[model samples]
Target: MAEAAPERVYTEQEVEAYLGENLPHWKLERGWIRRTYRTHSWKSTLMVVNTVGHLAEAAWHHPDITASYAWVEVRLATHSAKGITDKDFALARKIEDVVCWQPGREGGPLEGTPAGDPRFAYIKYDKT
Candidate 1:
């Protein structure tokens, strides 16, 4: 059975407390929980992006991702509610679970293989 989402409105205290206790790898910024990552190549970055897409679809909540040749910047915010909500917190947690940042780990193929260069491949991550 699917789990019901947390209530839509959370007080500022709730936001702060939840974030403080749960997301050590993410930082609250401009009403969003933000993180940045760089991959070995553009292909890896795209792979991470597609993985995030699947996650967003499954969660029915999305984040803001900026992917470039070698880096991906992710920002999660719940604009509809005007502040961070449980959904934002949930997504941030899920995202943190899937992005890796080992300094020299080659995520996989470079830009031209059949797998193609993703520039966004998602992997599990921790405080780097």
Candidate 2:
């Protein structure tokens, strides 16, 4: 038999503590945890949406995605449980990894992102 998926609903404290350490930009609110990724242009927004689309589809767990001119917000919660669950946390990490991806890394193809272009660089994180 296939292993069952984790159904444990994370307490508010657990959600805050884990997202605080791992996904600093994500915030808990309205019984959900979410983050909005700012992009440089409409094209960048499209790229972010497409990336999230594929990831969510592959994981078989989707979040409410809102894409606008230069930003995309992803919200996650286990609707069945009326709260967050381990699956939400797992997928959130995967989304973060790809959403903040840098070029030349093993990730979603940068076909739309211009080659070696500095303007495409969104908020740069220290290379620490």
Candidate 3:
């Protein structure tokens, strides 16, 4: 029987190149990949968390998730590698697909926010 090759820790240049033109919503932070999904209410927050939980379980790669009334922040890294790896990016892409899904909207993504959606307006990240 052959043993599986160990996963290599990604160089910053390799990671950046892989992201290419479609950066999605993830950001690199201190060796981790992080993203925060802001929702309109507690229900939406719970939905995101639950969906992520299921996906992570199936992927066998878990993330540090912080859930709040109007947001769910996820931080992903390959803990075994002590840094980000392909697994983090793969899972991040899956999460983004779930986030953009629209169950009954004819395949288009769900609307983001209205002109004055308070939940979207108050997040300080919005300023940047």
Q: Best by lDDT, which number? A: 2
TM-score of each: 0.66, 0.79, 0.75
Question: What are the runs in model 2 whose C-alpha is more than 4 Å off?
Answer: 1-6, 104-128
Alpha-carbon lDDT, every model: 0.71, 0.82, 0.76
lDDT of 1 by residue, 35-83 (tens): 7766667677888888788888899988899988877788887776677
Q: TM-score of predicted model 2?
A: 0.79
* Worst lDDT 10-window in candidate 2: 119-128
lDDT of 2 by residue, 69-119 (tens): 878889999888789998788889999887776665546665444556868
Model 3, 39-105: lDDT tens digits are 7778778878889999999999999999989899999989988877879888988987777654444
